[model samples]
Target: MALAKPSGLYPCTRSLPQAKTRSFPSLLQPKLHPSPNPSLKPFDATPGLSLVSSSAPVLHLRPRRGFRAPPRASSDPSPLEESPQKDATSEYGLLRRATLVGTATVASKILGLLREIVLAAVIGVGPVATAFNHAAVLPRFSSSFLGGVNGPIHITVATTLSKLSKESRRQLTRKMLNIMFLIGGAFSALTYIYADEIISLTAPGLQVLAQGNLIREMAMNQLKLMTPCILVSGSMAVGFGCLTSEGENTYLALSPSITSIAVIASCAVYILMKGSSSSSLNSPLLGVFISSGASVGSLMQWIIQVMIHKNSERETKFISWMDFFNDKDVHKLFALMLPATLSSGLVQITSLTDLYFSSFIPGAAAGLSYAHLLTMAPLGIFSSTLILPLLPTFSRHTKPSSLASLKENLQKAIVLCMVIILPITCTSCVLAGPVISLLFQRFKFDSSASSFVSSLLLCYSIGSPLWIVRELCAVVFYSLGDGNCPLLINLIAIFMNGILDWLSLSVFGLGAQGLALSTSCVSALSVLALLLLLSNKLGGIINIRDMRGPFLLLLICCAISGFTAMFSYRMLQFFLSTISILRLFGLTELLSILLAGILGMSAFYLPLVFAKFAGVFLVDSLWTTLLNR
Candidate 1:
């Protein structure tokens, strides 16, 4: 499961790797994993000036005799010549990406939460925290880099060209495709050339990997192998987004999942090679890196997409790529992507800066990253997953009335994110210690790391909701073909983040955890700025205030759940200490904490269950009602 499908409606869909293109046979090859559920449930906030439901009521009123509930209204645009019809009941395409993607993202976030707890408990907050985070930095940066590289041209070309002449459109697409590929390839080569120098800058000691003198030479090794992904992903974005807008999301959406699969495989392979020797395990330096993963995954993704694009060209005879460069279209593409890169690149640069500063500040090198991982566990769910799948459908609509409809969808997505994440973030902040204990206390992982990481996690959790909000705001603007505004906000926020990082980490002596807190603050500010900027441009294209009450309700519920979780944790601890026969009581107690916390959220949302409110507050239709009203 992944937080919102990062772009696809499911993990299978948002894999991002699907943008990869190879020859025909490989492209046509059957999938290796089970297909994902395209249908999902969504939670929502209320409509303005309307009564809302906490849950559907059991009523005497029933569907017409022999009649089923009317199929759900679709949120995606009515099909155009190039677009596909979304599910009538869907909140997105025919299948409703919001529901499927949101829920899976929620589930994935939950699992990621568990995964992080496990890592924290197992690794502790010291060397391992630094190591895992260090290992993660490149991959995280790469995704952001790719997002930046592709974000501009994607919306610019996709939104604009769909309005262009057919023959002119085809010709332009082929040229853009070729040029983008060549640029991405060049970027990959540059990364290969300077990976070590770059890594050394981020991690001073790891340059030894190039010398083959160290076991896991992290110094410069990590950057060398991983940076290539930014290039591959850049090339793939234009192709995938183009096809997806035309209603071909099956593979393109699922490609990112391949990265996860590859990472897992690489870890498993490394584990086997190393064995379980305590002596060898003592070294945090030896961790799984994904350069090879990128190399292989990129090929897989590229092969499939290349095949699809070429095959489609053969049948349709619609595209031409000769004279790709020096054309007006190339200029337009560059005009679109250039600002996007700088804007998107700002985030990665900040992250890289975080690494730089964190390394210098005592144990911070590891601590800040540890905390970030915990927070990201949820972000991957609520924010990344939803935004990725939503962008295309959203870009397809620019009409004032359509923005109104989509605002409701955004409202629904926001409420759903808060419902799950609010409770989790608050409870995790309160129970950071114990949860970290239960999850990561095995093998080479230790308690110190857990404690430190937990402190940082709590701080980061404060801004959990804002992360998703930022994504929604950016997507809304990007869909409107206004990348420049969001880009500006991202840069400004980066500067603010830098100042805060210095104050929190250096001035306050709050350490890595402080750095995380600073980042969260900046993130919230970015959300505010993005929203205001869009509102100015949109002439009220989007309205987030109507749902403020529901957001408040969700916040209140989260508070109650968190307080209850703390109480449950203490009581469970006491009971377990007293019962010898129930030696496994600790496990049972953890379950109670989780269950109670979940129920607490349910109890808070209970008001939305009634029929009147349900129409506006339910995830999909209810949300639609609320927004429409």
Candidate 2:
């Protein structure tokens, strides 16, 4: 008896000749087509149905005349090829990787916060702390713009390497590393030699202070100590990109904690030697110790990253030194790096501008630093985890054929960022005072410091979402191979930031808080301009009308969350006032902040779920992913 063909199975050709009958299990059938050449061996098609093509130009389905079908020839392509389902699975894998990276980032950020807390307690917002903070401007900028996970150097290396062949990438990595090392070494030498001049230029107002000479001297020494960071910073950034591209994201995501630990250890040693004595807390010696710790921490960061890159499975062969200047890919990296580096430098210039204006006001720089730490804790976690992973995906989708996918990804990224960050920004703004009090209002960090820092924190909070959007938008520009657009945007932003800084400080009498506000305003305006330009570039990929609904919803949710958090905090504070025991050691403030944040987030999330908002889907997906792991 003839066996029936499996349902939904059909031959690609209509004409065929009769052949021998075959009987086999239906499920094991291999779907195949007749070979054009009759001399070719017969191949299985739908298991029981084998296709045998003859010289007569007709194909025949027949029994295999054996119990098992012949093995697929080594020369034949596999039956399983790239399909939509496979592509989806690959995308899912990328998402899983991103989720893992994000989780590690959160852990790292928590450790970083602890490190900041330790520094605040040990150093306080005194002269030494202020001087260290000011002197750290250059090093901090270098790390953030160069060695940072999403910095210019990192982005350039990651983007360029993704497009090159395996052998080409190996050649390029060695060349880039060689070039960066030389550049970094020269920069470090120059920085070390001119530390005094750089400090004088950056913080000229320091010379007019009561302890101007002491502060200036300490700052110069601190700058000298941190000069080596210029060398390490470039290497670290390139290593981060290399490791991440090779799928070793855990190391890059968690490496900052190594630096944090190093700083914490250094502070711990200092505290041990001092024996809880506040008298010598802000001494010049302590400043030197902290500065040295910071430099050591940076060196440690570079060492760990380099080691990880070397040990990774994707390690490349070391190329000759001449290749550094001759490789086309290395030159492309330089082309991309130049504009990206300039863009990042402009951002640092904003920070420098703030420092310059802040120098006239005592303790303002330190307050700004403290406030910035709090703002960055959440931003860093979200950006490093979410934005960094999406960058490679974005670069992959930059081709004209994939523009639609790129547009969708960008829109989703923006919406997701708004959903997750908006509530935090609102809560921070509302509970700024209590949060700062709980975190830093202890030991030498007094109530005055808390007040000033809280004000700056609140102002900085207003710009948190803006900062995230700015970063995401920049990633889009970078992915599209147009780093100059972001450069231009930042240049304008720096100009605006400077003008606003002057007006807020010198004219409006806002002090440090005004500086923070100016940054927020500039970031907000810059992101809007960037979005407009990006939309035009992509043929109106962003529809303002479509965005308005989600934007409005998120705004409402944030406002509600902020109000609820404020009310909850006030009620808790009132209740704590009635209980004397709860007021000790900032217990009341701590409890209030915890309770307020919990209630606020609960309120913020519950409404979104009830309303079935678009953002809720992403939240659900992320939560599900976490649970599955």
Candidate 3:
């Protein structure tokens, strides 16, 4: 049938003629004989399909198993669909990004450890170290939680940016960057101006100490130097958020190492300048040098972030007045920040509470800081590498239909966290003295300091697993869109922590050890509360009866490892004393810790291996299942 032409009102439409039948080549159709044209060849036929061509010059093919026909030339467009090749490419890109992030994260952690060791060597647990720790409490906490990678600002930026189009993302990012700068500048100025009062408020116990006035002065000076870092950190966080959205995480992960390097260089320079001949440098002067390094490091991070942003194709003006005041997204970002700040602020308050209590105990602040660094190193590795992978799994299983699967995953994650952490916790608890002695007991850091910090480390290690559990539970709550629950729980925990801090000092007379113990106790209670709430929310996520056996076995294995490591250390230390030569330069301490640690790990894992081989599949197989996940 012929089609009619368009009317004047529909001028774009054209007339159509009757179309000829375009039959696809089939097995039933006879193949055309060869043509003399150079482009036409019999061998050009695809395997499993026969080609046919005629005088009018149409190419056709027979449909066969495992063969797809090419699309016929036409004026019509093909419908859009997802492409497997594109998915594969995206997955490959994601894998590459994860690898880069993981590597840089590990490097940053290593440098962080180096920074701690260097600080311990350079300053020891002296007045300078104590004052510096006090001054850094607020800056470090704010920069890390409010402005660091994965912080409130970073998360908000990444989340909001992901939902926007390219142009919208650029606009949102520009507005956010400008607003952060303004807010950060205001904060820096305020902190600098009020540094003295801030220090006094942060560590009131300092007033009671014999050298309290001197320490206070140093702290105020250090706080002022570090004030500008608050500003730089806020802007850097926004930059990190932008990089994260673009999947360029290498610099975001590694930039922290730069700060550690700068601090280390500063310490080295201080050591060289002082030389042993002038070992009595003024504490306040030393504080200035270290604080200056930190400030410079932070500035360098922001500079690099700015350079990266400028080099980007979507770069915007650095300080846009219009965006700062008029942008809705900028306002939205700050609005989002309020809740995040409150939630994180509660946690920091608890830490400051401990600092306030520890100030009267001389080097308690420094000791706590060092012990915390040690406790977090291993936990950080596990959290970043293993537990973080579970977020997507949690997200996927959030549907009502997959509630059972979510519950099962939660159980597995808890058990796996225990399996991996319990051994490390027990080992650390048993070898706290040797570990601290080997790591930090050096030129300035003495036996007394190691003994003091070892107690704190032991106390901190007991609650280490609980810490991981709390993080996991928080992750689950966040995945479920119930972040308020955790926030409320943390608010209660802060009050509880304050009460415990006071009780430890006034009631128990436990001093710094009491503070650490109070933290552990609070952690245990918090985990129990979170679990109970989680169970109620999900109609019970874990079966206590089902997990009792595995949990018991893990505890037993960890306990045995602890005893074995302690005994090994005792025997090794005694043997080293008989040799005398191995005692040179802390070799005896290092060797004992290393050898005992190996044996302890062996004792822990060997039992599990034997259980698997002997067909005792309860604990061993469950852990293996989690590991495979």
Mark the 10 consecutive residues where model 3 has the least summed lDDT.
1-10
Top candidate on TM-score is 2
Candidate 1 has an lDDT of 0.55
- RMSD values for the candidates in order, in angstroms, are 12.8, 11.2, 14.9
lDDT per residue, candidate 3, 1-629, as tens digits? 01111011101112223223233111012223333234322233222221111111222323345644346467734321112121111212222334446567778889999999888877888888989999998679757667776555565565456446788788878777776788899989999999999998989988999889989999999999998789877778788878766656668768878889989988878777775332544346777889989888888888888888888965656765864687777666666556655666786787888898999899999999999889987776555443334444455456686666566556545655666677788889999998888878887788999999999999989888888788777666655656567678789989999999999999989999999888888889889989989888877865566445445666678878999999999999889767767865657877888888888877876765543311122234334444543
Over all chains combined, what TM-score does candidate 1 have? Answer: 0.73
By summed lDDT, the worst window of 10 consecutive residues in model 1 runs over 1-10
Per-candidate TM vs. native?
0.73, 0.85, 0.77
Model 2 stretches with alpha carbons more than 4 Å out: 1-94, 313-321, 576-588
Q: Candidate 3: misplaced stretches above 4 Å?
A: 1-100, 163-167, 245-247, 277-282, 312-336, 386-415, 479-481, 535-540, 575-586, 610-629
**Pairs of residues at least 3 apart in sequence or in different chains that clash in candidate 3:** none
lDDT of 2 at 542: 56
Q: Comparing 1 and 3 by lDDT, which wins?
A: 3
Per-residue lDDT over 74-152 for candidate 2, one digit per residue giving the tens place of the 0 to 100 score: 9965544322222212324435666888889988888888988888887778888878988898888787667778888
